[model samples]
Target: MEHRHLGHSGLMISEVTYGNWLTHGELVDGDRATACVRAALDAGITTFDTADVYAQGAAEELLGTALAGERRSALVIASKVCLPTGSGPNDRGLSRKHIVESCEASLRRLRTDYLDLYQAHRFDETTPLEETLIAFDDLVRQGKVLYLGVSEWTAPQIDAALTLVKDLGLRSRIVSNQPQYNMLWRVIEPEIVPLCLREGIGQLAFQPLAQGVLSGKYRPGQEPPAGSRATAGGRAPTFIGRVLGTPLLERVQDLVPLAADHGMSAAQLAIAWVLAQPGVSSVVAGATRPEQVTENAAAAGRPLDEAARKKVDEVLGDLVDRDPAKTAQMMAVKPAWRTA
Candidate 1:
C-alpha cells in the first residue's frame, strides 16, 4: 500500500485505511472481523480507524483483539471521542472530563498505551472550544495521543479550533478531518478542502463509495442486494437512504464501464476518485469479508488520471451533493438533546 503524510504532520498513513464503522461486532461476528483485519494487514494496510461510539465500544475491543501481537509501531491506530458512550450526562461531548476519560477508556479497549491519532468526532458547540482543544493538547503533552483530528466539522469550525490552538500555543495542531466524501458527495471540495489546504489539515475521507452506492451493486429499479447495507436488518445509516434514488443509481451505472476501461471494479474506481481529490490523505473503507478488504486495498496505488476523473464528473453530472451546509447540519441537533 502507498503511504502519504497526514496533512503537514510527519506521520504517514496508508492511502487505504481499514475502518470498522458499521461492521465488526455490530454486523459481523468475531471470527469474520478478525479475518477481515488479517486481510487488511496482508494487503499492507497500516491504518485502522474506529470510533468510541461504534457498536457501543465493542468495535474497539474487537479491533484490539484482531491486532494483538503486531509491532505497534508499524500501525496507525486511530479512534475518536465526543459521542455518547453511555447514558450519563458526563458520558458525551468534548468536555475536558469526557475527553480525558474517554482517552483512557479507549486506550484500554484498544489494548494500546497511546493512540496514533485522537479526534473530536463532532464539534461540541456546548463545550468551550478552548476547553476541548486544550484537553486534546493535554493528551499529546501527556504522551497519550500523538496527533489530533476532527470529523464532519465545517471549515469555519475547523478554523476556529485551529485559531484557538495557535493562540493558546497548544502542543498539537489538528492534522486531519474525517468526512463523508465520494464521487456522489462533493460537499467538502467547495469549502473544507480549500481551508484545510491552507491550514495543513489533510482529509481522511470515509464513505468514499457513498456508503456502497457507487459500487453499482444497487440497480436503478431492482431490490437492494440481499444482506447489503441497505437491506441489512437494522436502523441503517441515513446517508445510504439519501443516495439510493433511481436517478443516482442510474448515474452510478454509467461509471461502471468507465471503471472497466481503467481495469478496476466500480468500488476501486470510487475510492480512486476520492484519493484524486486535493488534500485527501487516505480513504477509510470498512468490510465484512476478507476479499472486500483486498479489493479496496488495490485502489491504494492506482490513481485515476485527469481524463478518468473528468469522465466521472461528466457522468455524475449535477447529481452530486455539494451542499457545504450539510457538515453543520449534521452537528446542528445534538443527539444528547433528543428523546427516543
Candidate 2:
C-alpha cells in the first residue's frame, strides 16, 4: 500500500487506514475481529484507528489482542479522548484530569506504551482550550503519545487550538483532523479543508462511503439489504438511514458502472473518491470480513483520477451535503448558567 506523510509531520501513514468503529466488540467477537485485523496486516495496512468509547472500550482491547506479537514500530495506532466514558463530572471532556487519565486507560487497553496519534474525539467547548493543549503537551513530553489530532472540530476551533500551541510554546502541535467525508457527506469541503490545508493539518476522514450508502447496495426503492448497516437498527437507523433515500440511492447507483469500468467495487470507487480530495491523508475504512479488508486496502495505491472524480461529482450534483453548519453536533449543548 502507498503511504503519505501525515500533514507536516515526518510520520508516514497508509493512504487507506483500518478503523474499527462499530465492528469490534459490537458486531464481531474476538476470533472474528482478529481475522479481520490479520487481513488488514496481510494487505499491508500499517495504520489502525479506534476510540476509547467504541463498544465501551472493548474495541481497543480487541485491537490490542489482534495486533499482538507484531513489531510495534510498524504500526500507527490512534485513539481519541473528550468523550464521556462514564457518568461522573470528571469522567470526560478535554480537561487536564480527563485527558491524562484517559491516555493512561487507552495505553493499558491498547497494550502499548505509546500511541502514534492521540486524538480528541470532538471539541470540548466547555473546557478551556489551554487545559487540553497543555495536557496533550505533557503526554508528548512523557513519551506516552507521539502526535496529536482532533475529530469533527470546526475550522475556528482547530485554528484557535493551533494558535494557542504556537503562542504558548507547546511542544506538540495538532497534525490531523478526522471528519466524515464521502460522496454524500461533503460537509468539510468549504471551510474545514481550506483552513486545515493552510495550517498543514491533514484529514483522516471516517465514513468515507457514507456508512455504505455509496456502495450501491441500497437500491433506490427497495428496502435496505438485510444485515447491512442501514438495517442494523439502533443508532444505525439515525446515522446511516439518512443516506438511504430514493434520490441519493439513485445517484449512488451511477457509481456502479463507473466502478465496473475501472475493475473495482462500488465501495472501492467511493473510497477512491475521498482520497482524491485535497489534504485527505487517509481514508479510515471499516470491514467485517477478510475479503472486505483486502478490497479496501487495494484502494490505497489507486486514486480516482481527475476525470473519474469529476464524473462522481457530476452524478452527485446538489445531492452532496456541503453545509459547514452540518458539522455541529446537536447533542453538544452547553449547560445552563447558574447564578451563585
Candidate 3:
C-alpha cells in the first residue's frame, strides 16, 4: 500500500484502508478478524476505519484487541459517530452531548486515548452548526482528537460548518470528507468532488464497489450466493437489496470483461477507478476474509490507462439511471443516521 496526506492535515494514511463493516461482529469471529487485520498490515495498509454504530460497536472492540500489541503505532485508526446506538431520543445525532460521549466510548472500545481522525457520521439538522463546531474544537483542545471530518454532508452543509468554524475562531479544521463513490454511484461528482478540489479538502471514498455489486458477484438471473453478504438475511438490509438488485446486476455484467482484460477482479477494477479520480486521498473498503483484504490492497498502484478509463466512463454513462422518480425514492428513504 502507498500513503497519502489526508486533506490539508499533516497525518498520512494508506491509499487502501481496512474497514470492519460486515466481518467484525456479524460474519467473522475475533480470531478471524485478527487474521484479516494482520493480513492488511502485512500488505502495508496502515489505516483502519470503523464506526461506533457498526454491529453496535463490536467492530471497534474487535479491531482494538486485534491491534493491541506492537502493531498499534504502525497504523492510523479512524472511527465515526452520530448514528443511533439505541432507541432513546438522546442516543443519536451530532449534538454536543452525543458527540462528546460518543468519542469517549469509541476511545474505550478502541483502547486508545486519542483518535487519528474522528468524523461526524452525518449532518445533524437539529443541532445548531455552531454548537457542533464548538464541540469538535473542544475535542481537539482536549487532545482527544487529532483532526475532524464529516461524512455524507452536502456542499452547503460543509460550507456552513467551515464558516462557523471560522466565525468562532476555533482551532479545528475540517480535513476530509468521506462519501460513497464508485462506478455505479457517481452522484458525488457533480458537486462534492468539485467543492473538495477547490476547498483543499480530501475525499476518502467508501463503498467503492457499490456494496459489492461492482464485484461481478451477483448476476441478473441468479439468486445471490449463499454466505455472501447480500444473502445474509438481516445483514444486507432492505434498502441495499432494492438499490443493487437485478437492474444494477445487469449493468455490472457489462463491466466484467473489461476487468478481465486488465487481469483484475471487478472489485479491484472498481477500487482502482475511484483511486484514479482527482481529489481522492484514499478509499475505505470492507473485508470479510483475510484474502479479501490482501486483494483490495493490491489496487493501490494499479493505475488505469486512458483507454481503460474511457471505456469505463462510456459503459457507466450509458447505464446510469438518473431518473427523477428513482432519485426521489432514494432521498425519501435514506437513513436519518449519518454516514461516511
User: Per-model C-alpha lDDT, please?
Assistant: 0.89, 0.86, 0.82
* Poorest lDDT segment (10 consecutive residues) of candidate 1: 331-340
Q: Could you tell me the lDDT of residue 4 within candidate 2?
A: 92
Report the lDDT of model 3 for residue 266.
89
Give each model's clash number. 0, 0, 0
- Give the residue spans of candidate 1 off by over 4 A: 237-239, 330-340
- Tell me which residue pairs clash in candidate 2: none
Tens-digit lDDT string for candidate 1 (1-340): 9999999999999999999987877787689999999999999999999999988899999999999999999999999999899999999999999999999999999999999999999989899999999999999999999999999998999999889988998888999999988886677888999999999999999988877888889997799989788877444545466556777778788999999999999999999988988999999999878999999999988978999998987887777667787775643422211123
Q: Which tens-of-lDDT digit does each residue in 201-294 have in candidate 3? A: 8888988876777888888889877767776644754435645656557767888899899989989999999898988999999887789899
Off by over 4 Å in 2: 330-340
Models ranked on TM-score: 1, 2, 3
Q: Per lDDT, what order, best first?
A: 1, 2, 3
Q: Pick the candidate with the highest lDDT.
A: 1
Query: Which whole-number lDDT from 0 to 100 does residue 23 have in model 2?
Result: 81
TM-score between candidate 2 and the true structure: 0.95
Model 2 over residues 1-340: C-alpha lDDT tens digits? 9999999899999999999988888776689999999999999999999998888789999999999899999999999998888999998889999999999998999999999999999899799999899999999999999999999998889989999999999999999999988877777899999998998999999988877877888897798878887667445556664455776778778889999998889998988888888999999998777888999998877767889988888998877667787675523421111011
Candidate 3 off by > 4 Å = 237-239, 321-340
